[model samples]
Target: MIAGVGLCAAAAAATPDSANAVVNIYRAELADGSVRFASQRLDPGYVLYLPGERVAATSDRTRAGTSAAQAVLEPDVLRLAHRHGVDSVLVLAVIEVESRFRAQALSPKGAFGPMQLMPDTARRYGIAERAGPVQNIDAGIRYLKDLLARHEGNEALALASYNAGSGAVLRHGQRIPPYRETLLYVAAVLARAQVIRNLGQP
Candidate 1:
């Protein structure tokens, strides 16, 4: 049986809502056949076992503006990045450029949530609720991790792929795509990432 009682409690505490509030639950079957549960899918092994019955009402901070929303979501960003083996600063940068930390952000192209994930990308990662903060960041970070791996840790190429599609990267001789928007996007994310990293310094 899945020994998830403690894990479930931990998951609930990690969310923005009250500890008693309903939260999404995910299950992972370990190699030894044991099962684990978490509020967020920390890795590809975990799958959503139960969607939360009620979504948390938008917090006032989230509604105020980008900085406020970013402050509210930063913990999740850091946690998910650490769990998924991606740079937290890089994740923050992506979120800033994509949706400016707005949980319910919807792009003109139909990308949803803080990470601005396209529907196909969200579905590929088993994320049915793209507007949920934890779900969106989890899916986005995992996708970023895959892109980083595919590009051999070359963030530029990975970011370009994130913006223009991996096929575009491949078609362009595995270089950053030459599209103006993609070029600007890659530059902006990298610069923002550096800014975040520098902020931690003396």
Candidate 2:
């Protein structure tokens, strides 16, 4: 059976939002019937202790013009993005990639709402209802602003941190981690943001 002895101890000493601070944790069963934990998969012996959230697959729906749902939410996105000092188009891009404007969308990892925020992240940002559009977008833009600040306003690094957590970025020498999902996520959001910029906002 799997054990979380080390994981529990680590969690106990970590900040409440530590799960969102790191990307993944690996666990390896040693030859001595013991376990070792690491931030990355150092070798074949290690498996993901905490798996990262799967990036939502991209599709035409994500690239299409504003939908009825998106239109309904644009006002809040604009207002909150401005309030948080984030680009409205970038916020829209993230929403498009994350949930296609579906406020009720829920990921397999339990990230919910248009922003697809994990529960801990939502609570950390004082979001009582992850499915509420205004609250979700507000919290999301705020979080993005914080990430941008953490990375010194490097949009790519901020987006990468948003996808894979800041610890992953730091462990990789302040660069985007090599995880395929995170790479695609950063590219997708930036690409979508550019497209929105060209299209002159929804």
Candidate 3:
């Protein structure tokens, strides 16, 4: 009985949001056959520590030459964004506005990860490990790419769908939903995306 109580206490202490918790940053062989990282801590896995990728800045230009993924992006995020055919700036923008780069962030609405993907969104992208930063970002980028295509390149509409759902956007005549949270989310992402682009300029 005492041992059982001790195990329960240890499990509670190891939850992701616990400050000072240690996490695995690289892949390692577990006791099982698969390679994995320690998921018990918030800061585990490949950290996307982008200081300048915040949602506060100015200026920008239209898409030209290669996409933003090919133009300027952080090494890891750039690779994932390119794989999904998404603009790097847009991905960073979404992360900034969603979870501010906090890998363990969880919304009250049950969205998880830096991209704040809901459970269904994660499942749709075959991402069972929503707590893993790389997997979460990859799935979110893929979903964002699809949203952009579905909305005919209307970034605002795409963002609205991300925040409020595709059905909500479609029901509103393919326009941004009237919800205050969705409206603010779209504007914030756009502003942050422009900032990311401007900072990359020479």
Candidate 4:
């Protein structure tokens, strides 16, 4: 059964069931590690909840034929975002707009690794120094969480910071700044996020 090999490949990469994902959020420390005190597997929009904001995500490579990428990443991201009180729906939208789910994609602006951080920003976020998918994802998650915190939980402002940096957002007085790319980026992320949030694919 030569066809069976293809099936096995697909099955191996199949996304975990949202209802069955082992989801948890932990408080991580650079020195002492971290632990999860609260956890759950069920939350509406745990698959995608579009918070009203925009940010440029990478291309859609991640969501390509691989098929299972969203299923795998969405639930994990949602759980972590929920832990930090971040809206998973909005985050998924941003990811869709930004990376198109392309994990290994690189941006022209010197953003590297997944989540597409500029080399300098990646270093600051503790990614450039590390070499692994988990490290890259952790760095992105932590940085996004920090942005959410800085903007008083306003997803739009936080997304602006993610696009243009915190200094720019602060200079603009906690508003989504006027940078055209960032502005359009935010709008697209918000819209697509809404799409996936409503889709709620397993």
Maximum-lDDT candidate: 1
Task: Rank the candidate models, highest lDDT first.
Answer: 1, 2, 3, 4
For model 3, state the Cα shift of residue 6 in Å. Answer: 47
Sort by TM-score, top down from the best: 2, 1, 3, 4
Q: Write the per-residue lDDT of candidate 2 for residues 43-144, one digit (tens) a residue.
A: 788786433433343443243456899879888898888877787878887887677788887765677788878788899999875458789888889999
Model 4 lDDT-worst window of ten: 1-10
lDDT of 4 by residue, 64-161 (tens): 22246666676666666677666666666555545545566455555544466667777887556334544555667778888878766666667667
Highest TM-score scorer: 2
Cα error of candidate 4 at position 110, Å: 1.1
lDDT of 1 by residue, 44-67 (tens): 887864445433334232321238
- As a whole number from 0 to 100, the lDDT of residue 42 in candidate 3 is 27
Instruction: Provide TM-scores for the models.
Output: 0.66, 0.67, 0.63, 0.60
Question: Which segments of candidate 3 are over 4 A away from where they belong?
Answer: 1-74
Which scores better on lDDT, 1 or 3? 1
Residue 33's lDDT within candidate 1 is 38
- TM-score, candidate number 1: 0.66
- Among residues 3 or more apart in sequence or in different chains, the pairs in candidate 1 whose N, CA or C atoms overlap within 3 Å are none
Model 4 regions lying over 4 Å from their true place: 1-66, 82-85
